[model samples]
Target: MLHQEKISVRQFTILVFMYTLGTSVIYLPSLVASYGKENGWISVLGSSLIGFGVVFILNKIAQLDEKKHLFELLEFIFGKWIGRIISVLILMFVIYLLATNLRQIGDFITTQVMVQTPIYVIMIIFILVSLFAVKLGLEVIGRTSEIFFPYALFSLILLIVLVAPQADFSNIQPLFRENIAGAFLAVFPASEVPYFQLFVFLAIFPSVNKPDKAKKGFYIGVALGSFILFIITFMALMVLGPDFTARNQYPTYILGKKISIAEFIERIEILVAIAWFFSIFFKLTINFYALSLGVSYLLKLKSVQTLTTPIAFFVVILGIILFPNIIYFMDFSQFYWPFFAITFGLFIPLLMLLIGMIKKRKQGNGSQTPS
Candidate 1:
């Protein structure tokens, strides 16, 4: 595939940061707190460390063939038949990811702010908006991330400061009450969903204008995004306490509701929620972009843009079916999603790397033949 448009290193970094923050801000804090309790911060740190490792793996794989997108690299390294199978699995995962995110945000809005609105209505509208963004091309998505960067930052900082007065260090007293095993279990979900899912970025990595700087962009983006997540999880524990944090489906939203001033300032939860909404929009757009791109590549289509609408419509329909209710969504997210993530996010990439190395070695030996 031709690299027709390119995003600068800065833009790429911004996209990474936003994408990492996307689903994490709302969902992860509660999930981690539920498992690790007062030790949730440890789980957050553990997840971040694992996330960094995943980023390193992805960046190295991208380096293996700096010129080719991930799908092409798979085909190049694994041959046509196997590569097509891997590509199909990855494509399916991205679409499922897109659907879950759409379902998540839809659930959030209907349950919290839009009590009168239908859930499907919310999901469809959000899907349409994100689909339009994906249709504009990756360059546009990159630039859009730059514009949203400051807003996300400001809202995050503002929320932390606003909620600081409610902090109780005592809530986290007697650390490791559940011991290391519980925190370790929590770490898997925390890391897997937001961080490891970055595997999809391999599809987008070749679009970086400065291919050499791509590694730097990936590191900076993941570091910054994960740090923010750590802070949010810490704050949720400190302010809400682990019990309250875990009980509420959207702990961060409740955290938002707690942002009260002496008398006048209040009810800015919606404003804070917008930050998550914007971040998830970028996440959905990029994932949808990757899905469309993968499909076009597999089918030998001339342009990925051609399939955007049809794929997006399918995503909306699939989103409706994936989660019948919030209970099932949360159950899948907690119990099943991490393993599913590992299959595509961890195992597949590692297999590709191992196979890629073998292929390179064979080619090297062939070139040294006496004939």
Candidate 2:
């Protein structure tokens, strides 16, 4: 039997916001700064505009079949053979994402928070938490996200307010010096890795009880999350300077470190770390959940929960070996991740939508012309 669980619009909106904040807040400032320099925030804006377009496309695809989830719609839109091929490929990408997120959190903890702890231990603990969430199903994940949203939002607001003292608007000088091309070039990486990757949400959107509200919620969530990123990117440029921001692996963390209010309130970078952990945890859970669902759908299994353990194990193993080092990982994210994201996130979905539309039009004409 298909899972009958559903989440409210509010829950879905919270999930979308939390999911967007998950990895982008941790990595985007540095990456965008590196490409757009002093005007890096401008690049972020450009990327966000593209992100909105991607969301529009995704929303239309979701509306194409209110009753079918993304995986089911695949076979409906295409045909059995082609749809299965696409479904398998998407499943592989989803698993790869789970592994990447697992590795990312592990790397962040081992490098920034606890230099002495083993990375595998960190990965296992994170995986277990995500596994629990995935097993609980989408409604539970939605509720968990709703519960944590306020804390995460507060932490983010506090980080911004507290760090305001260190900001130097002069650091963002000569804003348009990079010209449109420079900013446009930065958009591919900045937006694709973070915002466009939201295509993954397609697999989960059908879980929403109010499908009509999904489009509105998605735009609101993406807009809000991108605005937060905009603020962080601008702040990083102003406080850390573009050159320094570009060079750092995690500029938001560095921004948190710069917080000092009369020397009495210091070392509150932990707040940023905490918020990042909360967001990333949800992100990992959602992706893992999607992966389990895909596996069950592909293998014709009855329950997604059964596949969770083996999938978690495989993810942990992949996370352990996926990246040889931090440099190579960051390099891949910069040069390679956008293309990978676009291929699955944008290209495949758009193609499916196009084909579905053509098929629908033909069927309508055929019925109208019946003898």
Report, for every candidate in turn, its global Cα lDDT versus the true structure.
0.88, 0.87
How much is 352 displaced in model 1, in angstroms? 0.6
What lDDT tens digits, residue by residue, belong to model 1 across residues 248-287? 9889989999989995799899867989988999899889
TM-score, candidate 1, is 0.97
Backbone clashes (count) for model 1: 0
Clashes of each: 0, 0
- Residue 203, model 1: Cα distance from true site in angstroms: 0.5
| Prediction 2 global C-alpha lDDT | 0.87
Best by lDDT: 1
Superposed model 2: Cα runs more than 4 Å off: 368-371
In model 2, pairs of residues that clash are none
**Cα lDDT tens digits for candidate 2, 1-371:** 44578999888888888888888898898988887788888888998899898899889899888767778889989899899999999988888888998899899999999999999999999999999998888888988998899999999999999999888888988868664566678988988766767878888888888899888999999889889989988898999998999899889999999999999989989899999989999889888887788788878998878889888988999988889999899888888988998999889989978998898888889999975
